[model samples]
Target chain A: MFRSRTRFRAYSLAASCLLLGVSSSALAGDAPSTIDPLNSPSWQYVQARYFDGQKLIFDDRIKVLAPTAAEDPLDVPIMVTSDGIADVEEVVVIADLNPIQKILAYQPKRASPDISFRFKVEQSTPVRAAMRTKDGVWHLGGTWLSAAGGGCTTPSGGSSGLWQGHLGEVNARIWPREDKNQRLRLRVIHPMDTGLAKGVPVFYIDQITLRDDSGAELATLQPFEPISENPVLSFDLKNVGPVHVEGHDIQGNTFTATIQP
Target chain B: MRNGVIGLATFVSVAAGAGDDYHLQPVPVGDSAQVFVGKTEGFARGNGGNIVNTGFIVGTDGVIVIDSGPSRAYGEQQRAAIEKQTALPIRQVFITHAHPDHFLGDQAYSGIAISALPKTIAAIRDHGEALSDNLYRLLGGWMLGTRLVPPDHAAQPGTVIVAGRKLRLIAAQGHTDADLMIFDEATRTLFAGDLVFFQRAPTTPNANIEQWLSTLDTIDQLDFQYLVPGHGPIVQDHAAIAQTRDYLRWLSTTLHNAATRGWDIQEVMQTPIPERFRSLSVLDQEFPRSVTHLYPDIELNVLPKQTAAKHE
Candidate 1:
C-alpha cells in the first residue's frame, strides 16, 4: 500500500506539471534573472521570426505593469510606460505563450509615452512589451503572470446572440491631456473570439483603421484574438478632428463609425 | 526572485508530506462554535487558496457544518477534525455560497445531506465544473481527486431546526447573487460567509458592491454575539461589519470617480489604496481584481446619457 501510494504521488506531480504546462525547472524557483525572455524558447522563436535576428537590449527604462496573477484571465489589464525614452517610435505587446503570441503592435504619434490596454491571457506566461526607439533598437521588458488558463480556449458565458444587435458598434470619447493634447479613446463591440475556444470558431476583428473625416488614415490596428472582448483602444492625438473608425471581422462582417471632435 | 524561492519552498514542503497532509486547525470561537481558521494568505499552490474559514456547531443531537471547504481532501480532514471533538454524526452540511472553496468539498460528505440556497445550488450546478477546473490548475496536487458535487437540499430563507437548535438562514445578495448568512439562535453566533471579510480583503469578482453594502447593513443589525467571516478571523463586535462596509463603499466610489474622470484601468489601479486598507492582508492582490470587476460597470455609468441610452 505504501509503495503504491508513493508511486501515485509521483505520478500526480508529473501529471500536474504537464497539466499546468509549466516545466518543473520553471517551478523549481530559480531567480527571475534566470527566466529571461531571450532565453525562453517562445521568445527566441518570436525574436527570430519577427525581428530578423536583431539584438534586443534588456532595458529597465521601459516598465511593464501587470498583475503577478490575473484575477480575470479574459481581461487581464496591462500598462506599458517608458521613462520618456527619446524618439520612441512604437511599442509591441507580446504574450509569449499565447496561441497567438503577438497581441498588438502600436505606433504612437504625439501620444503619451504610456499606454494601457486589456488582453486575454491563456495561461501563466511572461508578457512583454518591446519598445522600438528611433535608433532602431528594441528595448524589452516583461513580467510573469500566473493564470488559470482557458481565457482563449473556453466558451464565453454569453448567449450566442450577444453581439447580434451590438456588433461593430463604436463609442469614442476625447478628453484633454495634461499637455493640452487630446486623447482619443475608442471602444468597439465585438466578440474577438479566438478559434481556440471550444464550440466557438474563430471570430474576431482583424483590422481597425482610424481615419480622418477627409479619409486620411490616422492609425491602423491589427489585433488578434487575444484582444479582449469588446475591444477598447486609446491614443493621444494632437488637435482633435472628426474621424471615422472602420473594421472587419474574420467572417468579413464590416463595422464602421464616425467620431466627431 | 525572492517570491520564486518562496513559492518553491512551499511546493517542496507540500510535496514532502504528499499523503494525508492537512494543515487546518480548528479553534473554539464561542460557547459552541468551532472554526477552522485557514492560512490567512493569498492564493498560492502551497496553500491552494484554501483561505476560507469553515465552521461547525455541535448540539445535543448532531453536528451542523457551516461550509464544506475547498476540496474533497479538505472536507475529509475537516470531518476527521470534527469527529475528534464530538461523537455526534454530521447531520447536514450548509454551503454558504457557490464559490468553489465553499461547495467543492461536498463530495467528501457524500452520505451526509448537503444544503444550500436554491440559487447557490443552481450556481454550483452551472459553474461548478468551470470553477473546479480553474482551482485544479491553481491548486495542482491539492485538488487531486476533487470533483464538483451539487447540493442535495435546497435551503430557503427561514428557520430550520437541526439537532433541536434553531438555525435561521438569511438570503443575501451582492457578494454573490446568492449569499446565505446562517444565524444560530441557540448560540447567538452568526456564520457570515463571504459576506463579511475581516482583516482580509474581500474577493469581489462576483460582487455587486451596492447590494453588498446594503447587505452589510442588514447583517450589522442582526442579533449575534459571535461572528465567523468566510475569509478572516472571528469577530466579537460589529466593527468588522463596518470595516467591510467601508471598504465596499470606498471601492464603489473610487471606481465611480475614476470612470467619471475617464481614467484608464491602469490609472485606476495606480490610485493609492486608502491608508485604512493598507493594513488589510491581500490588499495588493484583491484590490486590482475589484477594479477589474467594477471598472466596466463604472464606465457604463459614466457614459454620455445619450450614448448610454442608445446602447440600451
Candidate 2:
C-alpha cells in the first residue's frame, strides 16, 4: 500500500498570470512531459495520442493505486482517484508497456471521480490514470506493475462460459454504507478478447453506461481489450438510488442490470 | 525468458543415458513401504521437477505405486529402484491427481495399469500438455522426453484389494478437482498425496480453501499410524496433517482479510509470515504463488459485501 502523491496546486496561477501580463486569462499550461518517473518508452507516443497539444501535468493529484507486481495479469485490480483536483471531466486509464496502451476512459457525470476496475497487463508496465479537470489540464498519476507478460495475447480459457453462450450475463450489487457513501459493483460476462490468440477474434465490451431510475446518465465507460474477461467495475457515486447498468460489446451483444442502493 | 520448445530435441538426446540422474533413493517407511521423498522446493533445472514425493508399497502379490514422479527420467528410475527391491510384478500405479509432478511421469510406465479418478483423468487430458510445457520452461533439459500420458483406467472410491493388499481409496476435492488418498490397511499407512504438505507451503492453483480445510478433518479421522505427504518428510503421528491444516487456515484468513480491505496483490504478497509458519520450507516462494492463485476469487467474493458487513 505504498502511495505517491502530489499537492494539488495553484488556483492562484490565473490571478498571478494577470499581473505577469500573459496573453490569455487561462492559467493552465502543458507541464513538461520529461517528468516521466516510470520513464516508459511509450511516453512520447502516449502523450501525442491522448493529451496532444493540450495542457497536461504528469502530477500526483490523480492517484493510481495498483499492485507492484501483477500476480494474475488477466485480472489485475486497480483503484484510480484524484485528491484536490475538482470538477474532473475525463479519466483515462493506460498501461504504457502493454500492447494495448489505453485501457479505458471514464466520464463520471454524477459520480465521484473514483473507480475500481480490473485490467490485463501484457508485461511490466507503468499503469496510469490521466484525469482532465474542468480547467482543461490533463493530470497523470501512475504506478509500476511488473508482469510475466502475455496476459493480453494469451486467451485466458479459464472463464469459457463468459464467452461462448452467456456473453451478456450480468451480476451487479449496490453497497450502501451507513455513512451515506454508496458503491456500485457490476460484472458483465464477455471474453474481452484482444484478437491476439489464434482463431479468436476481438470480442469485448466496449461501452458501459450507468444511469439513475429516471434514465439520467450517472457515468459512462469506454473499455478496451485490456479489460479483464468478465469485466467487473466499481464506482463511488455522488448520490444513492436505483442504478441501471447497460453494456454493449464490440460484437453487438448487450447486457443490462438494475441495482437498488 | 526463452521459449522451452527450442533445443528440446537436443535435450532429449542427452537425457536417455541420464535416466538415473535423479539419484532417486527410496527410504524405508515401514515394513512394506519405501518413500522416495523429493526436495522441498520449486521445479528447476537443478532439481528437474523432482520437487514431489512418490512411493511404492510391496504387497504379497505385486507392488502398488503411489505416484509417478515429474518426468520420464524420474518415473523410469523409480520403477528400476522398485525392481531392485522385489521380484514381484508392479500390480497397479495410482495417480494421486492431475498435477504435473504426480502424473507427467506416466510415460515411463507404459503398458502398466495406471489409474486415477475420472475427473483427474479428464483434467490430465484437458490441461496436461499445457502443464508439461510449463515445467519444460522451468527445467529445460531436466524435463527431456517427458510426455503427457493420461491414466488408462478410472479408479472408483472404495476398499479394493490390490496385489493381495487391502487398500481404501478416498475420493476428495480441495487440493484439486479430484484428489485420491490411499490407505493401506495392512500397514496402517496413508499416502495423502498433495492433499497434505508438511513443512512446505501448500500449492493452491486448483484449491478451494474451505473445501480443502473440511477434507483435512476427514483425513485426520483416518486410523493410520503413519502418514506420507505428497511433499516433505514422512510422519508417524498427525503432526504433518495438523501443520498443513494450520497453514492453510492462516493463509485463507490472511487473503480474505486483505481482499476485504481492497488491498492489491502486492500488499497481500508482502504480508509477513507469523513465527509459526516461518519453519515451512520455501514459504517465501510458495506463499506468493498461493496468493496469486486464490486472491482473484477473494476480491470478487469479498470486496462488495465486506464493507457493509464490517461497518453495519
lDDT of each: 0.78, 0.81
Model 1 CA deviation exceeding 4 Å by range: A1-38, A53-56, A156-159, A211-217, A241-243, B1-14, B18-20, B304-312
Tell me model 2's lDDT, rounded to 2 decimals.
0.81
Please name the candidate that would achieve the greatest TM-score relative to the true structure.
1
Docking class of 1: incorrect
Collision count for each candidate, in order: 0, 0
Q: How well docked is model 2, in DockQ terms?
A: 0.09
Using lDDT as the measure, the top candidate is 2
Summing lDDT over every window of 10 consecutive residues in candidate 1 chain A, give the lowest-scoring window.
A29-38
Clashing pairs in 2: none
- For model 2, residues B83-193, the per-residue Cα lDDT tens digits are 999999999999999899998888878888999999999999998987887677657776777888999999999999999999999999999989999999988889999
Q: Candidate 2 lDDT, tens digit per residue, A188-242?
A: 6677888886677888888999898899998999999899887778787766888
Using DockQ, give the best candidate's number: 1
